[model samples]
Target: MSALAYSQLPNHLQPLLAKFYRAHNSRNRIRSEAICWVARRGDIVGGLCLTPVAQGHFLTGLLVTPPERNRGIGAQLVRNAVASSAGPVWLFCKPELVEFYSRLGFSVANCLPATLADRLTRYRSSKTLIALQNDQRMMPMPNATLNIAIACLLDDCGRILVVRKRGTRFFMLPGGKAELGETPLQTLRRELREELDLQLEDDDLDPLGHFQAQAANEPDHQVEADVFIARLPRAVTVQAELEEMAWLEAAPCERDDIAPLLRGHVMPALLARMAQAERVACCAATSDQGEIGSLAGKVSSIASSS
Candidate 1:
């Protein structure tokens, strides 16, 4: 019922992991440099390893006991490994498992990087593996670029505001491409007003950070995003300019339709901010209660004296 890092795992679990690797015929692939996540219920029930490869990180040696297979333990282990990873993550799974991984936010690539190509060949030669259909439409062309300014608007209940543009399935933070002469804030302000009919002043927006990711709408181009945080009133109505709007809880695992930048970066930052704000509010509430207690004590003393 708990997940542990490779180093934090007890000595007793190593033999179990080795057995799992042996069962998968991947015993030789274990590396000390790799990060492993082990899931345990009483004892080790499942595990997965993430090794640093030239392309990014390669996921390997995934295993779950028969009893634990359908219970989602393997999925949780993979999710934890991916969330902990800093950069791109890659994995090689059986053809049947392609849909499983795809639902976890990995696209089936027609061609892999040079580092993964050799491994793919080895895997195919060993097993009856076929190449995933090369989808040119999903592949980004070389040397493409896009610029966007995105807003991270949170409602009173702390859910984030995300908008899905017309004809696109991915729901991303509200905002759009920046104009040539506009600052990031200006771009966001204009985009919000134009896209959502929501007016924001400079004081209402807090600069979160700048990030770059594969553009959701434009294939082969990277979108450089300047992200900002704004708080929306609970009663505000969002009038969509392009398609539709929804308040999202920033939960990445529940859905795979979120934009990459938001899933990988912006959501983490927003979550951190939410935590900090909650802490501040907690401290203020405690301080206020302490002040009220002190005042109450003083009044009680005065009444007693009188």
Candidate 2:
């Protein structure tokens, strides 16, 4: 399967998309002005439409064919939209779906456009729905905002690999500033090879998101980072501009040497992800236990009857 984004609604895909939504029993339709992100496997299997608005971008129609559900097509569409969009992306969904979208980094919106706020109030009065927003933190750029791509290389024990550049006091994630004509993945790959003697393909990385935090080495500066997670194939040595390398605990206790970006923003996000994982695991275990008990009871009943 492949995905694509179209700035304008294509003339040929109009009817097909309309039919796609109808098959899913949705009445919402896409407008020509909205940006289109589509997932295709021989045909369109999933799609999400982004409509420009004063606040940011309002998502209009989102659908995935029944046969294509649980294949991560919807996630790809939403991730592409948020990463490529200039600002936040907003949507309304039923309460049951809140958990699904929340796993993709969406949260209940604290604020919204006056018109949308009003619309949500009226809609919620009649249905069980809530508003969500995915903020890219691009509304206003900070002073000396450096855009960098960084890696979150975790070890078998769940420790993160950190590096200190030559003559720098701060220890940061393994990455550097984006050079001319380079994407985030390109920057991460180049930086890792140069700094840590590590090699990786784009598919090896799981993009966390673009994040903003205080700059590590510079005073009164900020950094916008494209963060990713991947495994370390083997132990690494300091190389290139790196002077030292270290491993930080999943929740690091020492922060005097850690970079502000890692200590402040990245750590919190990581911890949140870990906590969510625990909750999911616990739920799955309980479900499995219940199923096991049911099977045992059935077996005992059959033995007694026989």
Compose the digit string of candidate 2's lDDT tens values, residues 45-95. 788888887768988687887766544567668877877778888899998
Residue 154 displacement in candidate 1 (angstroms): 2.9
lDDT of 1 by residue, 169-256 (tens): 9998888888897877789899888877788898998877666668777776767777888887434444555677777875653578
Best by lDDT: 2
Which predicted model would earn the best TM-score? Answer: 2
TM-scores of the candidates in the order shown: 0.49, 0.56
Estimate candidate 1's alpha-carbon lDDT, on a 0 to 1 scale. 0.72
As a whole number from 0 to 100, the lDDT of residue 263 in candidate 2 is: 84
- Runs of candidate 2 with Cα error greater than 4 angstroms are 1-142, 252-254
The regions of model 1 sitting more than 4 angstroms off are 1-143, 233-241, 250-253
